[model samples]
Target: MFVRIVKMSFEPSNIDTFLKNFEIKKNDIRNFEGCRFLELYRDKNTTNIFFTYSYWDTEEALDAYRHSDLFKGIWAQTKPLFNDKPQAWSVDKLESLT
Candidate 1:
């Protein structure tokens, strides 16, 4: 499994709008092929900071989703809300306790 995390910092006034957009499209993104899991988290100390945690079957699967029309539509709406360039990383588990 591939684990992906994306950290985003949004403009203060855009936080609510960003959450609304994310909520509207979250299900469709989670249901995409090879998507195993999806979730969003907000920073307790920073209201405009958020993170997205997701799992995919493989890097190729995630790439395919990134290139899809759904991604384009969602991203177009999402990009303008950013206060900073987003950070993203992918990992494969080597060990787990649970």
Candidate 2:
């Protein structure tokens, strides 16, 4: 399994637009092939910051989604709202202490 996290900071005045766009695309993204889980998070103190957390069955699956038209469309609607460059991390399960 692969885990992906993306941290995005939106221009303060554009937050609502970003949220609405995200809301529109969330289901399609979640239903994409190989996507096992998906979530969105907001920073408690940094009100303009948000994160996208997702799980993919494999890296290839993630790569496919990244190259897909769905991503292109959503990103086109998203990039203009950014206040800073976004950051992303891809990881795999190593172990769970519990």
Candidate 3:
């Protein structure tokens, strides 16, 4: 499996709006085909920063989701709320302790 991690920095005032939208769309994202898992993490010291950790079956699966309407809608709502450009990483899982 592969993991996708996205780091997002949001405008302080837009955090709540982003969270609400994420809550509404989380289920759909987790249930998307080839999505093995999904998680969201907020930086402990930086309230405006967040990360999305997700597992996918393959790179093609991820690309499919990226091109879907669901992603488009979600991005449209999300992109405008960011204070800085989002950063993402796609990597193969090398180990898991648990």
Task: State which candidate has the highest lDDT.
Answer: 3
lDDT winner between 1 and 2, please give it: 2
Candidate lDDT scores, in order, read 0.95, 0.95, 0.98
Local accuracy of candidate 1 as per-residue lDDT tens digits, 1-57 = 989999999999999899899999999999999999999999999978999999999
For candidate 2, the TM-score is 0.95
Residue-pair clash count for candidate 3: 0
Error of 1 at 50 (Å): 0.4
Q: Name the regions of candidate 3 deviating beyond 4 angstroms.
A: none
Give a tens-digit lDDT track for model 3, residues 1-98.
89999999999999999999999999999999999999999999999999999999989999999999999999999999999999999989999997
Q: Per-candidate RMSD vs. true structure? A: 0.9, 1.4, 0.5
**Residue 77, candidate 2: alpha-carbon lDDT:** 89
Instruction: Give TM-scores for every candidate, taking all chains together and pairing residue i with residue i.
Output: 0.95, 0.95, 0.98
Q: Which of candidates 1 and 2 reaches a greater TM-score?
A: 1
Q: Write the per-residue lDDT of candidate 2 for residues 1-98, one digit (tens) a residue.
A: 98999999999999999999989999999999999999999999999999999999999999999999999999998999999999999988788596
Q: Which residue pairs in candidate 2 have backbone atoms (N, alpha carbon, C) closer than 3 angstroms, thus clashing?
A: none
Candidate 1 CA-lDDT value: 0.95
For model 1 the local lDDT of residue 42 reads: 94
